[model samples]
Structures are given as structure tokens and as C-alpha cells.
Target chain A: MKEYTMVVLVKQVPDTQNLTGEAMKEDGTVNRSALPAIFNPEDLNALEMALQVREEYGGTVHVITMGPPSAVEVLKEAMYRGADRVYLLSDRKFAGSDTLATSFALKQAIQTKIPDFDIVFCGRQAIDGDTAQVGPQTAEKLDVPQLTYVESIQELGEKKIKVRKLIDNGTEIVETALPVLLTVTDTANEPRPFIAKKLLKYRKAACEFDLPKILPRYPQFKTKEELKNFLKKKGLFIEMWGLEDIKANKDDVGFAGSPTMVKKIESITLTGKGFKKIEPTDEGIAHFVAELIEDHTW
Target chain B: MASNGEVWVYAEHDWNKLQDIGIELLSKGRELADELGVKLASVIIGDKVTRHATILFEHGADKVYACEGSKLDNYDTAKYAKVLTDLTGQYKPQVVLFGASARGRDLAPRVASKLRVGLTADCTDLQIGDFKAPDGTEYKKILYQIRPAFGGNIIATIVNPNTRPQMATVREGVMPPPPSKKGKKGEIVKAIIKMQNLPNLTSILHREKTEKKVNLKASRIIVSGGYGVGSKENFAIIRNLASVLGAEVGASRAAVDAGFIEKDHQVGQTGTTVRPALYIACGISGSVQHRAGMDQSAKIVAINNDPEAPIFSIAHYGIIGDLNEVIPMLIEDIKKRRVE
Candidate 1:
């Protein structure tokens, strides 16, 4: 059996479960700090799928994320779950990226860092953008075939993989050659929880962002490079890449490359009207049915 | 500019029957064609879809491009995508619409990628408008792709001004299906794609239907329960109500997460979005996540213990009470009314 190399695309999203009115700012932008940051739900499924592939095919699973410096938290979580390597794709020039620009930057980063990977995994969509376009768009940018809504892997051959994809009514079995991209849905599999040993080992994981802040605390490390060297030597550090490192055009990486713009954002609020409040009695039930019948509710 | 001056709809169908979304797109496409002073076209790719062009014509297609071959039979993504992309390149359409069904969702992105055009998936509403860019340039006949974003907190309107044959996958049931006109005919363009040259990477071996599961998205009436249902066994009340009302059973994320029901029955942001004719929410507090899926129902009836539950705000009828007590009474009354 041949070993496979997998790249999983993950994102740190604002927790939508505990959302509140304060989560949205006056400018229609999300106040990401108003809510806790968590790993994007579907990305966990993608990571789990990648890990499953690694377990079966005997290969390494690497995770890549694009966000602010704080987004490295997801990388730590990925390491705790099971990722051989992690890379952070972040820079100021990458801000305000829509699905297109984000995919462009990610494609460049993948091409630069892991060009020989067998498979690229991504969640169907991000909870924040809800576009579901980045994965497919990124596949297009790389000129690779992509399968979306993948439910399971039926077989993994040396050159191709057989997959079952969820359609609207049924599942479609497809075989795609290696070096393909797959966008996994939540129904793919239940993501395994963190292992105790891995958690304990990776809890001290730090990237470039944490080096400057933690260097002051360590008396022995006088320079940022020295601490970084120590952490890299200990295998407790994550790799960070910027626009220049990936050779991505600045104009094609951010807002300038984005074609879709939010012309407006309208908050939806339901006004309670035209509804008859009824008590939980027989008469109330009778009136409701009578009204429904009169209005042809059936 | 390749202005074919026609609006095309991809007629998605299984081997047995045509998908309703195909006709729904034709209905919307007809309106767009009239607005743009163009013809409405349909593309069907399958083994025996040549005979189904009349069906497309009746559903408002002014022209049908039928590509029939054995390779097009089982919906190999690569082959069907190549046929559609080739046809589109040969005969360019101003705009193309596809059903946001499973096959449509998969194929649209591939064709769009090949064509290097923009595609908006799962659009709830589509409109034709003239878009004025912020740079002061004007684009005519733009496809306004409207869909819920940010977990349904807001709606975003997207326009693909630079791409030809602007593509969008309309969500099933968002647009009404036009009544078919019997014996209606249309011009047919036959392009038999040679499958020998294409890459055949995948093949289906055996297909077992994964049980006849709940069809909540396609159901006309749905009775959904939330975490307030208390226990997994307490779901009997919801099932009993659905049986009496002849409706499908649904659940919120809380109920599904609690193991009260399976994931397929979940109706929320992460679940299936539905636009049923009537929705009865029992013990549901109507969180944004839950409401995002079913707020488009024509009539909503909420039954909850708390009078201030957010579900009541969008409901057409609100009953303040315990669902266990209220549901049994409603079921009994409905049964008696049916008997009478």
C-alpha cells in the first residue's frame, strides 16, 4: 500500500450557537470578539476524515488555516486531535478576502508549501461566510478535480479513491484520481475527541505570534529568534507563511481581488402580528383548527 | 461579447422521472427571458432524455438541447460536466440556472470552473437587474443572486457582471413550478458527446437505498419538536400529532443533539432548510438557527409553555401551554373533525 499525504483546510469561526445581537456591529461587520472563537464545525469533520485516511493509508496529515494570529488556537486543537504538521497563512494584505480571494491565497500557499500532497480536504462551507465556494474555487485555481458533499470513502487505491457523495435524495459513488480535492459535509463522520496524551503534549504549542509575548517570560531566551529556535527544536512550534513567502500577488490576495461585495445587510426581525394568542384549552384548540381550515391550511 | 440572447436551464432528472426543480427553474427562466427579450432554453443530458424535451417545452422552454448517450446515463460528473460545458461554449446562453439539488450542486461548480465563470449556489431568490459598479460602470442584464448569509441573519445579493452565462443554482421549491402545457414543442439541438476520449475514473458498483427516510424538506406540512420535548421517548407526542395531521415530523438541533431524534429530521441552520406550506413548532423556542430554516413557511403555528418564546413572533398562531397536554388535545380534535 502506498502512503498518502493529506492537507486539511481549517478555519476559526465565531461561535454561531451562542450568538447575540451584540455579535453584529453597527457597520454590519461581525464583532468576532463579542463571541467566543471555535473551530468551524464542518472543518472538524474534514480533519477527522483526513486523519482516517492517514490511519488507513499510513501518511502524514497537515492542517492549514488562514486567519488572524489568534486563529492559531485551531492549529493547536488540530495538533491535539491529530495533525503531523500545521501552517498558519496570515498577513495584513490578506484581510477583507472574500471566497475568491481567500481561495486564491490558499491555493498559492498550498502550491508553495505542500505541492506533492495526494489529497486536499476542506469543509463544504464556513459557518461565517456560508458561501461554500472557497473549496471549489480553490480547486479551480489549482486546476484539480473536486468532489463536494463527500459522505465516505469506499475504497482507496494506489492511484484513485472511491467515494460516496451525498446528493439530495441519494448517494453517488465516484472514483477520482489522487491529488483530488474533497469538501466534506457534517454527515461524513463523527469527529473523534482529543486524546489525553496528545492534548498534554501539544498544550504548549506556540507559533510566531506567541514567541514575542512568551519570550519576555523566559529568562534564558534573550531574542525572539532564539526562542523560536528552541521551540522548533522541541517540535512545539507551528510554521507561519505570509504573502511574500507564498509568492501571492498582493492585489490578488485581499479585497482588491474580491468580486463580490456586500452592497447592504438587512437585519431580519419578525413583528408579532396577525396571530391570535390562545390559551391551552379545548376552545383555543378548536378556534385554531377552525381558522386553519378557513384559511385552507391543509 | 457572445450574446446568444437565450436563458438556459439545466433539466436535471433521474432515469425514471424529472426533478421538480428543473421545471421550477424553467418557470423563473421564462420570466427572465421575457424581460431580456430572449428565448428560454433547456439542456437535458441522459441516456434517453431526447424524448423528454417536450416536457421541458411544456414547462416553458422555447428550445431544448438534448444530449443522449450511454455515458450520460448514470451521471458521471466528469462526462456530464464536459457535455454541458462543451454545449455552453458552442452555443452561449446569456444566463443559466440549475436546481440546487445534489447533482446540480456537484455539476454546477465543475462546469462553472471549466467555463471560468462565477456561480452562486443555493440561491433562494433570483432577479434580473442592471448593476452599477462602484467604479461607475454599468452592467445590464445581471443575474441578482439572493441567498441567506451569516447563518441567515441577513440576505446577500450577488451579481456576476464579468462572467458570461451567469450561473446560479436555485434552491428547490423557492420558485413555483409552472403548469405544463401539453403537446408543446421546441427546437432540439442534438450533440452526441464521444465518451471514449474522456477520463473514466469512477464507476458505481452497487447502490442500496438507505431506507425510506423522512422527507421533511419536500413535505408540505411539518410538525417539529425541540428540546422542550424532554426525552427521546417523549417524541411519541410529536409523531402522534404528525400522524393525525398527516404531516412529517421534524426536530430542532437541540432535539437532535440530545438524541431525541436522528440527524435527518433536524430542521435548523446546519440542517435542511424547508419552505413548507404549514409548519407547527412544538416546544421550540425559535432560536435564530432554527428559524433560519423554516421561517419561510406560509403559515406557522407555535405551541410553547413560555409565552415569550421567539417562535411566537413569526408564528401565525400562538398557543401558550405545555406541548404534552396541548398536542394530545389538538390531535383528538383533529381526529374528531375528520370523522365528522
Candidate 2:
């Protein structure tokens, strides 16, 4: 039996899937008030796939996320399911990063926070951007192989990873070497429910998945010892990593590492109006129905 | 110029069979190739997919790029990316088009980002040459890549002038395939792709294909129901309509919420986005969410008593009456039309 260590990448997004006009920020980013924070739908699936791997193959599932301090909520949600550990990659410097810069920031945090993981999984793309670039770009940054549109992770062995990828018209079976990144599509797998006890206990726990960053705001946490005490009282599990923590070169560690840049942000509207419904004349409607019958494609 | 370089298309395969989109892409690629005066090519990477390669040539690929091996047998994201990215860099095709299928949606953007180019997803239309510069302040010459935006309410033409190769994903069946010779001979460009070392994190143990699957987007005809149907029981009207038309049953978000149908049957922004030729929207209010999915239908017929229903805004025909009366009447009329 080959042991495995899986890392799932998550994002703290304004529950835009459920967001309304109310969540609209003046600048187009979701208004935090209007949009409730939630874990991305695909990221949850990635974590679930990881947990299942651990359940079947026996290993650890570590979840990591990059966002504002509030992102800890998403990491905790991962823990409630069965992730052995979670890491929060929160830094003010990480703000305003597009897909290119965003992937670099996350690669740094993943490298520093989790030393060794056999595989890395992420949602095919973040729903907010729907760009679907981060996972593949991250794979490029990590210099590992990547598989997108992954519907199923078919096999996990020491040397290889096989997945049933959902193609447009059919399915493709894929096998690749490990230590690879995977961007799971919506068809990947449905997430299991949160563990009752874990959810109940940690329901109110402060989302302090990153200790170093949070300590700066709470001056009362003057020392590591004091912060640990406060964390204990708060029952906060703050995963920690610093610039010196990983084998990261300063040049390629942050904004400098990314290649693509967003030149401008525009709130552009796209419309489509076609499908000329023939008038509901008995003759026209009947002919249309006949056409439908001939096509056999309802 | 489209003619300066060959038109590159991402030919899709499902291990055993080639996707219809691959052929559809080839058909469009041939058109684009003609528009630009170049060749059409398909990229196939898998194990023993020669059968598919022959099919690609018939669909109109002037050339085929096939990488066959045990490692290439099944798709490994990392491996496929490296392989495809390396191919793109070497071939340097002007435009690479995908099907906007689940796999295409995921793979296209990754390749685009890797190549530092621009990509448009879920497009319903494709045209060669320049597009308007959407820049508010300055009018720059940009590659007008247009796609349905705001849930199919408008067509947003985007561009990535700064990048090298432009990429776009078209929905299935938008461009029908041209008649191709099943065994047409074409030159196969075999390449040696180096596999990158990767980590093992998670794996799949089983695959049970019995999930509530809905292939609405792929259907040719869709009988979509909406809130005007009143109750879940009214869906029988839709089911009947579908049976007469031999069409797949679809629902608006409202109908899905009313328990008229499963989420899989729901069509909209949050549901399955389809571009069927004939769309019959019964009692469905054309919310942006609902329209996003079915609005791309080649033809739309709306049935409702509410004359001002938003659906009528786009429907080709609107019947001002109850669907219960209209649907059954229409079903009988169709039965009569069949005889005629």
C-alpha cells in the first residue's frame, strides 16, 4: 500500500453562486456585506476527493487557502469533513493579484506551509473569476504535470495517477506521474456532509487558521507563548508559515513570479437574443413540432 | 492574417470514440482556414487512437498531430498540459479552438494561460479577423473574440491583442460538420513529448456512472418547462410535449424549485447551458438565469397567458393563452400534422 499526502487548494470567495446585486461592490468585486463568504464549490469537491483518498489509501489530507483573514472559515470547513490539517495563506501583500500573480502567491504559501505532499488538487477554476486558469498555471509554477476536467481519480499508485476526465462529447481515461496538480470539474464528485461533532464544536470557533498574521492585529498576543494561550482559549488552530519558512527565492516568491497581468477591469455586459420562435399559428407551430420530431433532440 | 498560420483545433476523444465537437471544429476550422488561406489541423494525444486520426482527416483536418503511447493512453492533466503546451510552442498555430465541453473548458484556459495568450469560453459564434476594441477610453485594434455574456442577453466581443495565439471555445453543434471521407488519407505529424515528473497525492478507487446525469447542453431539441406550469404535476404536460416532439425534457430554475423536475433538467446560468435548434419554453419566465441556458436555442417558442412575459422578449413566437389548453391542442395538432 502506497502512502499518500494530498493538498487541496481552496479560496475564500463571496458566496457569489448565491450572491445578488446586493453583494455588488462599488468597484465590481463582491461587496462583502452583500456576499456572504463561503468555500468555492469545486474546492470543496477537491477536498472531498482527497479525504476519500485517505479513507481508501491511508494518508493525510491537508487543505490550504489564500484570502483575507476571513478565509479561515473555508479552511475550517475542510477540517470539519476530515482534513488532518489546514493552512491559511493570508497576507495583505497578496491582495489584487490576478490569476498569474495569484498562483505565485499560493505556490509560495503551499511550499512553505506543507513540506511534502504526494499530490495537489484544486477546483478546475474559481467560480468568481470562472477563468479556470489558476490550477493549470499553478501546475506550471510548480513545474509538475496537470490534468484539468478531472471527473474521477481512478487510481493512485506510488508512481502514477489515473483519472477519468469528462470530455465534451464523451470521457477520456488519463494516467500521469504523481506530485501532479489536478483541476477538478463540477462533475468530479459531490462533497460529503460535514461531520456532526466537528461542525458543532468548531461552528463558533474563530477562523484563525494562520497564527502569525492574526497575531499582528491582537497586540495583547505580545509573545508566541501568550498567543498560543489565547489560541487555546479560542480553540483556534492557526497554521503558520513565514517568508523564511520555505526554500523560496525572493525573486520568484511573490508578485515578481507571475507572467500574465490584467490590464484593465471592466464591467462588460454580453447579451444573446436569437431563436426566432415562429408565430404560434397552428400551421407554423405544427411544422415546428414536426421539425423537432425529425431531429429527435429535445 | 488567418492565412499566415494553420488553424489549430483541439480534437476531443473519449478513449474509445472521437467527440462530435472534434468534427464540428474541423468543419469550422476548414472555414477559418479558407478565410485565412491556411491549413486545418487536429491535435490527438492518446493510446492507439489511429482510428480517430482517420476520422479527423475526413472532417477536414489538412494535418493531424498524434502522440500515441502508454503514458498518453489516458489523460494526465500535468502530462497533457506539458505535451499540448510544447506542441503549441513548436507549431505556433494562429488560433486554437476547443468545444467548450467540460474538458475543453478546463484545458483551453490552462493552455491559454500557459502560452500567455487570451481565451474566450462558451462561445455561440465564431468569425475571423478583427473585432471592436471594447476599451472605453482608447480605440485600439483588437482581435474581436465574441461570446454570449450576461447569461446570453448580449454578445460580448473580447480580444487579447497582446498575446500570440488566440483561443476560443464553441458550444457543440454550433457549426455542423462538412461531409468528410471516413478513410481520407492525411499526413500524420508524430512528435516526441517528454513527460514531466509529478507527485502522487490522491487517487480514485471506483467509478460508478449512475449519478443523476443530465446532458442537456448536448441535446438537439429541448422541451423546457417553467413556473407558469403551476405545480410539479403540470410537468406531465411538458413530458407529453416532449414525447410528441421526441425531445429531451428541460426546466427553468423556477420549475426545478417547484419540484417540477430535477436540477439536472434545469437550464439557466446555474443550470445546463444549451444551444439546441428548437426550444419550447412552457410556462417558463425567461429569467436571466433560465435564459442563460436556453436563450442560445436556434428557435424559441413561448407559451403563456402573460403576453408581456420576459420570455416573449426573445421568443420567436408567443401564444397568448394557457399552456394546458395550448400544449394539448398543439400535441393533437402535431399528431394531425404528421398525417399531413
Candidate 3:
């Protein structure tokens, strides 16, 4: 059996569905701090697909994400669900990156760290942005074929792979050559739960920012760097890479590289003061329907 | 630098028949081109698709670019992107718009990335406006791509001021097609598709297309449910009401996400935007995302136990009661009236 190297891209996004009143600022912009950051939903599906492929074909699944240091939480979650390795592409210079710039950063990281990868998987879109551009843009940057809205892997071979993709009205089974990128959709499959043993083992996995909290427990390791080295030896370290580490040019990594800019944001406010209250009784219901009929709203 | 160039719409078609969104965009494209004092052209890339250019001109296109070949019979992302990218680079279109359909969503980003320009996704509205950078650099007459962000908590207006050929994928049904002129005149250009260097990496094995079961955009009235509809079985009440009233069944994104209904029946920013004559929201707590799709409906009726649900605010008639009870009574009342 030939082993393949698969990379899954993931993100930690604000829980937009369960937003609190404080989710918005007085300036009518999102207060991202007020919302809890969870692993992007579809990215979990992508990870599950990668894991399933590895189980069938015997490969190592490497999960990567680019965000603030807090994003290491999703990397740890991915480890608990059977990922072999995790990388955090973190740098302050990468902030305010739109899809194109973000994809450029990811492409640089992939080429620098995992250039021999056979396949790359990504969620169709992130919940917060919902632009769904990063996956294809990254594929273009990598100079590989892209399969978007992929629902399932139909066939996999040494040189080619086939997938079922969801279209506007139907599904198409498509085959592409090796070294391709796939954007997994939510309808693909239910993500597997965390393995209890893996969870217990990786619960202490620490990135650079987490070293301080974890170092207090390991007294023999006097410094955070020492603790990080010890964790690396124990296979519990999540590697963090900056823009320079990935060989990305400073001009192409952040707001400086982004073409689109937010001109304005308006908070939606609905006013319903003119609504007529309708009773729950049959008579009121009858009268309401009659009015609807007379007004041709029926 | 390309401000005086033509505004182009990617006219997608199914087996040579132009999609409705293409015509709709041509109408909007006409207005934008007129405002910019340039031509409004459409690009249709498929085998034997020249005949569709007639409708494009009738809908207000000033010109049509038909790129035809036997290899272009079906949509191949790499091939189509290559042709469009080459055409865009050569002709220097000032603005490019796509329908934001599945194909559009897949193709637009690839072309935009190749061009190294910005492309906004799922724009609900577009306008010609001026934009100023924080550094006091002013840009005149740019495309303002308006869309809901953060799950519709706020609407953001985006601009690509420094890029040529400002590109956007506009949502279908938001921009209604203008009335067509029967004998509108336009120029037609036959574009040569150069596929020599393009990689053919993907091949379609089989395609299964089910006829679209729900046409909420064409429905006159709609009875919609939300997560508060409780269970998939309880959704029967919503369907019962729809059946009784001869209306279509619509579901909020929450309802569709909860597995209470299929995605086809979803009505919201992420789903179908509708403007039915009557929209009855049953047990739906209208988020801004939901209201973005249906607030334009002529009359709205909200039935929810919670009086504070946001659906009531935009609804013309409000019922502060349980939908499981109020809906049945309303259904029965309408049934009895039909019998009488």
C-alpha cells in the first residue's frame, strides 16, 4: 500500500449562530472577543475526510491553520481526532488578510513546510467570512487542480482521485490528477468524535503561547523554551511558524497585499411598529384570512 | 487606469439556453456602464452559444463576446477560467460580474486570483460610488459591493479601488432584470479560445441532475418555518398550512441547519431571496440573515409564542401565541372558508 501525505486546512471562527448582545460594538462592527471561538464546522468535515482517506490508504494527516496564537486550540482539537501533526502559521503581520493574501500566506507555508504533500483539503467556506474563496485561491497559488463543494471521495488511486461534488441542482462525479485540492462541504459526512485516549494524551499539547501555563506544572523545566523542547521530545509540541519562517514576502502577507477594503458597515435595524396584533381565537383567524383574501395576499 | 473600459457580465447557460441571472445582470450592467459612460458587454463561453447573444442584446447589452469551441461544450473550470482570464487581460474590462451560482462561485475566485485582484462574493447589491482610503487617497466611480457579513449581523460595503476590473459575484434574484427592448442593437465579437497551454486536470464521469423541486422565487405566497418548528415531524404543520393556502414551503437557515427541512427550501441570505405576495413566518425568530431574503414581501404574518422574536418587527400581522396552536386554527379557518 502506498502512503499519501494529506494536509487539512482549518480555522477557528466566532460562533455567529449563537451571538450575544455584546457581539456588536457601539461603532456597529463585530466585537469578535465577545463571541466564543469554535473550530469551523465544515473544516471538521474536511479533517474527517482526510482521516478516513489516511485510514484507507495508510498516510499521515497534517493539519494547519493561520491565525492568532489562540488558534492553536483548533489544532489541539484536530490532534484529538487523529491528525498526526499540526502547524500554526501565526504572525501579527498576517492580520486583515483577505482571501487572496491569506491564500498566498498559506501557499508559502505549505511549500516551505510540506512541499511533498499529495493532497490538500479545506472547508468549503468559513462561517464568519463565508466568502468561500480561500480554497480555490490557494489551489491556484499551488498550481494544482481544485475540486470545490466536494461531498465524498468516490475513488482514490496512486495517480488520480475521484470525488462527488455538489452543484447548484445536482451532483457530478469528477476525477482529477494527483496533488489536487478539495474543498469539503458540510453535507459530506458526520465528523468523528474525539478519541478518549487521544484526548487525554494531547490535552497537554502546548504551542508557544501555552508554554507559560503548562510550564508551571513541569518544575524540572525552568524556562518556557526548555518546556517547549521537552514537549517536542515527547511529541506534544504544536509548531508555530511566522511569515519569515514560511519564506513569505512581507509585501504579500497582510493588509498591504489585500485589494478589497471595507468602505462602511451598517448594523441592520428592523422597525415593526405598524404591525397589527391578531388574536389566537378562530374568529380572529377567520377575519385575518378574510382580509388576506380580500387584499389578494392569499 | 481601466475606468473607461467595458462592464462585462459572465453569461452562464445550461445547454445553450441563457440562465435568468445572466439576463438580470445584463440589465444591471447596462445601468453601471451608462453611469461610467462605457459599453455593457457579456461573455458567453460554450460551444454553439452564439444564439444566446440575441437575448443579451435585448436585455440591454451593448456588445457580446462569444467564445465557442468543441472543447468548451461543457464547463471545465481550468479551460473557462483560462479563456475568461485571457479575454479580461487583453480587453481590460473595468468591471466583471458573475451570478454567484455554484459555477460562478467556483469560477470567479479562480479568475480573480489569477488576475491578482479582489472579488467580493454573494453581493446583494452593487452601486457606482466614490471611495476614499484612510491615507486620503480618493477613488472616483468604483463598484460598491454590498453584502451581509458576520452571519448578517451587519452589512458591509466593500470596494476594490486600486485594482483594475473590479469583480463581484452578485446573488441571483436580488437584481431584477429590466424590461427588454425587442429590437435593441449590439455588436457581437467571436472570441478565439486558446486552450493549447491550459491543463485539463479534471474529467466528469457522471452527472445526476434532479429537477429543482422548489421554486420559492416564483411562488406568490410562502409559509416558512424556523428552528422553533421543533422537529422534522412537527414541520408538517407548516406544510399543512402551505398546502391549504396554495403557497410554497420555506425554511429559515436555522430550520435547514437543524435538519427540519432540505436546503432547497431554505429562504435567507444563504438561500433563495424571495419577494412573495404573502410571507407567513411560523415559529421563526427572524435573524437579519432571514429578513434579508423576505422583508420585501408585500405582507408578512408572524406566529410565535415569544412576542420578542425579531420576526414580529417586520411582519405586518403578529400573533403572540404558539404556532402549533395558532397555525392549525388558521389552517382550519382557511379550509372552512374555501368549503363555504
Candidate 4:
């Protein structure tokens, strides 16, 4: 039996689409609470693909995300959909990292969370960064095979797999050896929604056992022991791990491991240039055709 | 401080015929190689690709390293990168170039990272060093890699300060194809391609291919509708024009937001990048995001009621009337022209 492990990279970004009048940030970075947080549409599609792969063949899907602790909201979504394990790399030290530094943190997490990597997948690009660099860069750091703009994955074999790259006209079918990385386009497939049973069971579950939301809802509890007892009774336990639990060096947890620095940020709007409509006369048509000819165009 | 002499071009295959961009890079590489006084080589890998190695001679490749074996059957980025990276270490080219297709987009970053070098993607132009009078032309021999930056607002000239081989990915149709001549020949170097058995990474048991693969990016003609198209029902008139012109139907971001069409047909920064031969805007106001997708089209025609719409900025032809009326008339005129 061949063992297959699929890892998907996800990110948390402000809901850029829901820019309303009530809350607006001049700097372009959103106010965290005012802006809705959702799993990236493309990353969700990537996870849907991974879960489907798991259903067809018996394997594990591991999701690794690097962000603030609030990002765990999406991890629970992944777990609800048959993920074998999930890991988060969250610390204030990783703040203000650009694409280059961001990729470094992800590479470190991929190594720490899963010792071995067979196939890694991610959305073509994130809505916020829009760089589309991290996936390919992560594959480079891992020194594995990569396929981008992937429209379909045809088959998976013992030592090799076949994939379809959406090219200019027709699809290009490729048969490559295993341990390949894929950065998928949204054209791949429609993502699946949450299951009714999984949603109900895992609603209040936490990995950190946060005492804020749960204890207050049930005010009858008098002591810390009773609250823990009720939480255990209600299945609100989370598998929380401290920094030491993951065996990461204290220095490497944040800004120290990052190597990229932001240069600047600018907001721009490009529109309304020149609009000159010429006559339907021969000279006017002749002038336009001549320019096209000079430019070697159709 | 390293060997800044060898110029490498990544090759492509179309219908068993070599991709024109591969030779285009070589032709451009010749100019750079001449200025730097270095050698120009190509990397070609495929099943039975060794037989086509002679194609490099027609161009200006001085050396061709062919990696042809059973393991080289398909393009696996891991295997391809390993082989290409090994060659880079051995040859130490001054620059490595590839077509900016999907493969190139993914491959260039990996190669650059492995070599710990810089890579400029979707480059539009290439020029060898500065002018010759020390500053006049010799500086250009440094291979000024030019690419569109700031979302195509400006073109930036990038160069690797201290890397063995500077790398770049160039878009298709950006440069002219290489011309064929009778007499140039190059040496073909053969290398062994080995593979390693790895674990089963991902099991994609079944992938149902999309029944309809309508890629608008490569289409020659695109007919795009906008908010001026009125209700979603009016989109039929726009579609009629497209059907007659044998073109793909597109939508401005506003049109997609209005539910006039699916997001896939939307042409803009958030949708798809398109550079067709001809673009027809049906009552569009031309938002910046919409213009970003079709600004590169060769010709544009706008039909709007406002007359003050921004889409007129790029339109080569204009009709200040309703699209419902204008589209039918244009379709009639095109039919007449074809019949005549």
C-alpha cells in the first residue's frame, strides 16, 4: 500500500468585496472586526479538491496556515471536512512580513508540522496579496515538482500522477513522478459546503480551550473546577499546544525567522485618458489602418 | 562576480513543432550574447525530443543540451527543476529565460529560488547592456530585463546584482519569431536523466474535465457588454453580435456584478487578463478594472448612450446609440461584408 499525504496552504484576509460606507480604512488594510473574515474562495476550492481526493482514496489531508490566532476559525472548517490533522503558526513576531518573508514562515511551518511532504496544493493567488508567488516559492523551498494553472488532476499512481494544464486552446495532459506541488486555478471545481452534523458537533470546539465564550454562556458554574467539568461534559475540549509543545525555538517564532521587509504601499486609480473619435472618412480610416500596419498588428 | 557569459533559453513544443518564443529568445539572446561576447545555449527535454534537437541549429543556439528518456515523458516540475538546476550549476549561464505560460509562471520562481537569484516575470522587452561608450551601450550588455510593473502602469528594468544566471519569464506574442536560414548549425550535447521513486503524494482518483472549455484569453475577438446593456435579458443582443463575428462574449466587471453573465466571462483585473485582436464594448462605461483586461487588445469599438463613457477612450470605432439597436445593425453590416 502506498501512503499519500496532501497538504493545502490557506490564508486569512479581510473581505475586500464587502467594502461598505460604515467602515473604511484609508491605509487599505482593513479594521479586523469591521471587515468580515472568510476562507479565501480559492483556498476553499483547493480544500474541496483535497477532500474529494481523500474520499476516493484512503489518505490524510493536512492544512497548515500562518496567521493570527483567529485564523483557527478556518482550521475547524477543514477538520469538519475529514482533515486528518491541522496546524497553525501564529505569533506577533511574524507580523509585517512581505511575500518573501511570508513564504519563509510558511516553509518553516510545513517542515515543522509535517516532517514529509508528498503533494502540496494552494490557490493560484490570494485575494489580498494578489502576487501568486508564495505557492511556487514554497514548492521551490521544498524542492518538489510543481504544477500551476491546473484545471484538472486526472489520475494518481504509485510512483507517478497525471494532471491537465489548461493551456491556450486544448488541455495538456502530463504524467509526472510523485512528490509534485500544484497551485490550482479557481476553474478546477466548485467547493463543497459544510455538513449538517459536523457543523452542530464542532461549533464551540476550540484548540486553545478559550474560557471567554463558553463559561459566560453557562453562568451557573461557581468554581473553575465546575466550568472545566461542564466543558468536558459538553465536549468543548480543544487540543491546545503552547509554543514549547510544538518544539519551536523561541527566537524563531516571530520576526527573527522572517527576512523580508515592506518598502511602501500606494493606492492608485487609473482611468479616463484620451477619447478622440474620428470621422468615417477615407483619410481617417486610412490613418488608423496605417498605424496598425506599422505596429505589425491585425 | 561569477560566469556572466552563457545565455539560456527555455524551449516549448507545439504540435511537435518548436514554440516560436523559444527561438525568439534565442534571436534576442544572440544580440545580448554578441554584446557580452558569450555563448547561447538551449535546454530541451521531452519524450523523443532528442530527434528534434536539430531545430536549434536553424536558430542561433551554439550548444543544445538534450535530456531525453522514459522518465522525461512529461513535465514534472520537481524532476524538471532538478535536471535544469543541475545544468545551471554546470553551465553557469548569465541568464535563463522561459515563455510566460502557466508552466513558466510556476517554473521560473522555483529555479530562481534554487539558484538564490532574482527573477522578473512577464517581461515585455529585452535589451543588451547600456550604450558602448562605457556608458553609451556597454551597460545595456548587462541584460536589462524589462517587465510591466504596478499592474502594467510602468515598465521596470530589473537586473540581478550578484547571481550566476539571471532568470525571466516572457509572455507569448511579446516578441517576433526567429527567422529561418540555411547555414547555422550547433553542437548537441546528450545527458542522462535519472529519477527517484517517491511516495504517493496526492490521489486524485477522478477528475471530470470541463465539458465546455471556452478560454477567452486566446480568442481573437471579444464582445463585451456592460451596465448599459440594461437588463440581463438584453445580453442576448450582445451575444448575437458575438455569434455573427465568431467571437467570445465578455462582460465588464459591472456587467458581471449586475448578473448579466458569469464571473468567468468578466474581463478585468479580478477576472481574466485578455489581449485579443479585436474588442467590442456593448454599452460599457469602461471601469479601470475592465480596461486592464482588454487594454492590450489590438482594436476596440465602443457603443454607449452616454457618449461620455470612458470606454470611448480606447475604442477605435464608436456608435453613440443603444446597443440593442447598434448591435443588430453591426451584425447586418458584417454579414453583408462577408457575403460580398
Go through the candidates in order and give each one's DockQ. 0.50, 0.18, 0.71, 0.14
- lDDT, candidates in the order shown: 0.83, 0.70, 0.90, 0.68
Sliding window of 10 residues with minimal summed lDDT for model 1 chain A: A262-271
What ranking emerges by DockQ with the best candidate at the front? Answer: 3, 1, 2, 4
Spell out the clash pairs found in candidate 3: none
Error of 2 at A88 (Å): 3.5
Q: How well does candidate 1 score on lDDT at residue A144?
A: 72
Residues A159-260 of candidate 4: C-alpha lDDT, one tens digit per residue? 677887665334666666667777787889988888777777767666543665566666898655677766566654444333454455544334443322
lDDT of model 4 at position B36: 77
Write one digit per residue (lDDT tens) for candidate 2, span A1-298: 8889888999876554554666554543334455577788888888888888898999988888877777788877887887877777766555555565666666776766665767899987665555566787677667666777688877788978888875444566767677888878767788998999888766544543445556787787786667777766665555644345544455444444433233323342222344444545677667766665676633
Candidate 1 vs 4: which has more DockQ = 1
Q: What is candidate 3's lDDT per residue for B91-193, written digit by digit as tens?
A: 9999999998888989999999999999999898889998889999998999999998877777899999999889999988777777899988789999996
Shift in Å, residue A10, candidate 3: 0.7
Which residue window of length 10 is worst by lDDT in model 1 chain B? B200-209
User: How well does candidate 4 score on lDDT at residue A252?
Assistant: 39
Task: Provide the lowest-lDDT 10-residue window in model 4 chain A.
Answer: A259-268
Docking verdict class for candidate 2: incorrect
Q: Residue A80: error of model 4 in Å?
A: 6.5
Q: Name model 1 segments beyond 4 Å from true.
A: A20-33, B1-4, B192-200
Writing each residue's lDDT as its tens digit, candidate 2 over B1-340 gives 2226678888877636776787887877787778877788898878877667777887789899887787676554545666788998898887788887776766676676677565767666666654333354332332345555432333455555545576777776556667877677788898788765543222323333444466675667788888899888878999998888778899988787778788779887666777887888888767655765666587788888887566887787677778888898788887786788
Angstrom error at residue A94, model 4:
4.2
Model 1 DockQ vs. reference: 0.50
The alpha-carbon deviation from the true structure for residue A81 of candidate 1, after best TM-score superposition, in angstroms, is: 1.2
